[model samples]
Target: MPSKLSEEISPFYVMEVLERAKEIEASGGSVIHFEVGMPDFSTPAVICEAAVRAIREGDTRYTHSLGILELREAISEDYENTYGVKVSPGNVIVTMGSSPALFLSMLALLDPGDEIIITDPHYACYPQLIKIAGGVPRTVRVYEEEGYQIDAGRLRKAITKRTKAVLINSPGNPTGTLLGPDVIRDVASLGVPVISDEIYHGLVYGGEAKTILEFTENAIAVNGFSKLYSMPGWRLGYLIVPEEFVRPLQKLQQNLFISPNPFVQRAGVAAIKHGKREALGMVGEFDRRRRAMLEGLRELGFVLGTEPLGAFYVFVNASGISPDSHALAFDILENAHVAVTPGIDFGQGGEGYLRFSYAASVSDIEEGMSRLGKYLDERKNKSR
Candidate 1:
C-alpha cells in the first residue's frame, strides 16, 4: 500500500509544539501555553442551547449537500447585515470547517499544476491544502517592516500564466496583522480570483477587518463559527463564492462531504442569527488578553513587528535571543515551562520570529511572561 504524494506533506509544526507541551504536562509539570490558536473559553450559551434543543428534537439526520437552507440563508444575511455585502443563499456552501472549505474551493477551481500565490508568512496549512488539491503554491515574501502585508507589486510580479488564484488571510494567523482596503483592492485588480480567510473577522481588537467582497466580486470568502463565536468543536463553517462558481462548488461538496452535520447546521443558524451579542462579548475579553501579552513581551525586550490590530496573536522577532526559534521554543518549554510557537512553522520570512497566542486567560499570560522574564534574566547573568 502506497500513500499519495500529497500524503507526504510536511507536518504542521505548531501541533508538534503542542505535543511536546502535553508530554511535559503528563510528567506532572505545568506549561503555560501560548502556542495553540484555540480559545480557552467554552462555546457560548446560546450556541450550546441550540445544539441541545436540536439533539432533543431528533434533528441528527443528514441535510442538503450545500447545507440546511436555513443556515445557508442566515450566513448570507450575516454578510448583508455585517458587511453590507449582498450574498444570495444559493452562493453559500456550508462546510465541515474552513479547512474543508479551502479544500473544496481549491479543488473546484484549480487544475493540476495550476499555481496559487500566497504570502510567505501565511497560515501553515494553506500550502498543504493547495498541494492536496493538485495545485502548486507560489509564495511571495512579505517583510515585517510593512507589518507582514503582501506587497501588491510583489504579488503582481509573482503571477505567472499558471496562476489561478491569490490566497490571503486578514487578521492573519501568527502575525495578526490586518491588511487594509487599499491592498485588498490592488490584489483584486490583478483579475485573479482571491480567497479571503476571514475566520478572525469579528475577533479583531483595533478595527473591523475588511471583507474581500468590499474590494472585488471575484473572490471566495471563507468564515467559520470557531474563532468569532467560540464554537470550535461545532465544526461548522461557510464559504461565500461567486455566483458563477456556486453550482460547481456544490457538486464537489456533494461528492466530498454530502453536507455538514445536520444538527451542527442548525446550531450554526442560531450562532449567526441570535448569538451576535454573546460573540461580541468574547471579542472584548480577547482584546484585554491581547494588550497584556503585548506589553509583557515588550517588557521582556522582544521586538514585535507591529501592535496586533485584529487577531489575538503577537509575532515577535526572536533573533536577538536565538536564530533558531524552534530550538528556543523547545528550550523555553523545558526550562521555563512555557510553550510558544516557532515562526518557522509559518514560512521563511518568519524563521527568526515566534508567535504568541493570547487566547489564554490574563493570569496564564502573566505567569508565562514571568517565567520568560526569569529565564532571560538568568541567561544574562550567565553571560557575565
Candidate 2:
C-alpha cells in the first residue's frame, strides 16, 4: 500500500474536467476550454530563441542548485522594477516552477503538525502542498460578497499557536481578484510569516497587485514564467526568501531538484530583460476576454458580485442553477461542450460557484458564452 501521506493527497479536480474535455475532443466533438489556468498564447519569440541559443551553445549541464546567477539577478531586478522591493540576488532560488518553490518553502518551514493558514476558495493544490510538507492547513473563509478577498482580521483570528505561516495568492486563481497593498499591509501586521504567490503578478487587468515583500521581509514570494511569459512548459520558477533562509532553502533545492533546467534559466534571463512587450500584449488580449466573459456571465444570470480586476478568471455563483457544482460542471461539458472549472474544486466556500477562465481567445470566449446561453435556455424551457 502507498504510505498514508501519499493517500492523503487529494486529486486536483479540475484535471478531471480537462480530461473529459479531451475525451470529447477525441470523439469528434469540439469543446471550448476554460477549465485550465494556462495561457493559450504562444511563448514570446525572444525567450524561445534564448533557449535555443543556449542549447546550441551546449549550456545544458547541471547548473548551480540555486539556479544560474544571471536569472536570479534578473529576478531581483524585476522585484525592484515591478514592486519597488529591493531584493538581493542571493535571496532568490529558482526551481522547476512555482509549485515546487512553494512546496520547498513549506518543507523547509513546516515541522510535523505545524499549521499554515490559507484563504478558503483558494487554489486547489494549496492544502495538498501543506499536507505534503507535513503541515496542516487552516482555512479562513472569505465570502463572494466581499469579492473573495482575504479578511486579515478573520485571518488573524484563525491563527493559533501552531500557525507558522499565512499563504496568499494575488490575482488569484479561480477568482482573478487582486489584493491591494492595504490588504497586504494588514496581513503582514498579523505577525505570521506570509507566503505570497505572485505567479499571476503581471496578468492584472485593473488595480495593481501588491507584493507582500512591499510590507514585510519576513515573507516568501513565489513567482514564475508560466502565466505572464506564456512559458508554462519551460518549467522555470523562483521564490524570494528572507536572507537568512537562503542557504537552507538552497540546500533543500540541491537535494530535491538539483536545479531548474540550465537552458531554461538562460531563457528566463531573456524573459525578464526583454519579454515585456509580448507579455503586455497578451495581458491586453486577456483583459478583452475578461470583460466579455464578465458581461456574458452576468447576462446569463450568473451572479458576479464584483468585476474581477486581475488574472484571467471570473468566479460565478451558480447556486441558483444547481447546488452541486461538480455535477453541474460535468453536465455543462457533456451537453454544452464548454469546459469550466467547478468551484468546489477550490474549497467549500466555492461549492456552488463555477470558475470561468478567460485565458482562451476572444472569439472562443464569445462562442463559449453563446453555447452556454443556448444550453441554459433549453434547460429552462424543458423545466417550464
Candidate 3:
C-alpha cells in the first residue's frame, strides 16, 4: 500500500488550472494566464551564453555535492554585497532548485512529530513539504488588512516544546507583500531556527527584502535563480547554512540529488556576477504591469486590502461576488478564458480570495481584466 503521507498530500490546484488552460488553448481558445508565477521574460542573455559556453567546453559532469567552488563563492559574495552579511563559501550547498533546498532543510531539521510554524495563506507547498518530512505544520492566520504579514506574537504563542523552526517567505507568493524589517527582527528574536525562503529577493518594487542572516545565524536561507534571473527551467538553487549544518546537508544532497548539473552551476555564477542589468530591466517591466493590474482590478470592483509592491501577484477579496474561490476561479477560466489561481490553494484563510499574477504582458493583463468585467456584468444581468 502507498504510505498515508503520499495519499494525504493535497493537489497543487494552480497546476490544474494551468492544465485546463492548456486544454483550452489546444482547442484554439485564447487564455490570459494569471494562474502561475512563472515570468514571461526569457533568461538573461549573458546567463544563457555562459551556460552554452559551459556545455560546449564539456563542463557537464557531476560536481561537488555541495556545488562547484566557483558557484558557492559567487553565492557567498552576493550575501556580502546585497545583505552585508559575510557568508562563507564553505556553508553553501547547491541544489536542483529552491524546492529541494527547502525539502532538505525540513529533513535535516525535523524528527517525526516535530512542528514548524508557518503563516496561513502561505505558499501552497509549505505544509505539504513539512508533512513529507514527517513534521507537523502549525499555521498562524495573517489577515489581508495587515498585508498578510505574519504576526510574530501569534507565532510565539503557537510554539511548543516540539517546535523545530519557523518558515518565512519575503515578497511572498499569492500575496506579493514584503514583510517589514521590524517583523523580521522580531521573528528572529523568537528563539527558533528560521527557514527563510528568499526566492523573490530581487523582485521587490517598493523597498528591499531583508535576509534573515542579517538578524540571526540560526537560519537556513533558501534562494534560487528562477524568479530574479528568469531561469526557472535551469533548475538551479542553493542554501546558506551555518557551518555546523554543512556536512549533514552535504550528505543529504549526495544521497538524494548527487549534485546540481555542473553547467547549470556555471550559469548561476554568471547570473549572480553579470546578469543584474538584465534582471533590473525585468523588474522595471514587472512594476509597470503591477500598476496596471492594481488599477484594472480596482475598476472591476475587487477589494485589494493592501498594496502588493513585490513579487508579481495581487491577492484580492472575491467573497462579495462568490464565497467559493475554487468554483469561482474555474468559472472565470471556463467562461472568460482568463486563468487565475484560487485562494483556497494557499490555505483556508485564502478561501474567499483570488490571486492574480501580473507575470503576463501588460496587454494580456488588460485584456484579461476586461474579459472578467464582461463576465461578471453578464452574470449579474442574467440573474436579474
Higher-TM-score candidate of 1 and 2: 2
lDDT per residue for candidate 1 within 65-99, as digits (tens), equals 88989998898888998889998999999999998
* Model 1 alpha-carbon drift over 4 Å, by segment: 4-7
Candidate 2: regions farther than 4 A off: none
Model 1 lDDT on a 0 to 1 scale: 0.89
Score candidate 3 by TM-score against the native.
Answer: 0.99
Model 2: lDDT to the true structure? 0.91
Clashes of each: 0, 0, 0
- lDDT, candidate 2, residue 41? 88
Q: How far is 88's C-alpha from truth in model 2 (Å)?
A: 0.8
The lDDT-based order of candidates, best leading, equals 3, 2, 1
lDDT of 2 by residue, 1-384 (tens): 999988867888899999999999999999999998899989999999999999999998999999999999999999999888899999999999999999999998999999999998899999999998889999999887887778887898999999999999998987888886788899998889999999999998778989898899889999999999999998989999998888989889888888789999999999999999999999999888888888888888887787888888889988888899999999999999999999999999899999999889888988999999999998889889
Candidate 3 residue lDDT tens string, 241-335: 98888988988889999989999999999999999999999999999999999999999988788999788999999998889999999999999
**What local lDDT score does residue 123 receive in model 3, on the 0 to 100 scale?**
94
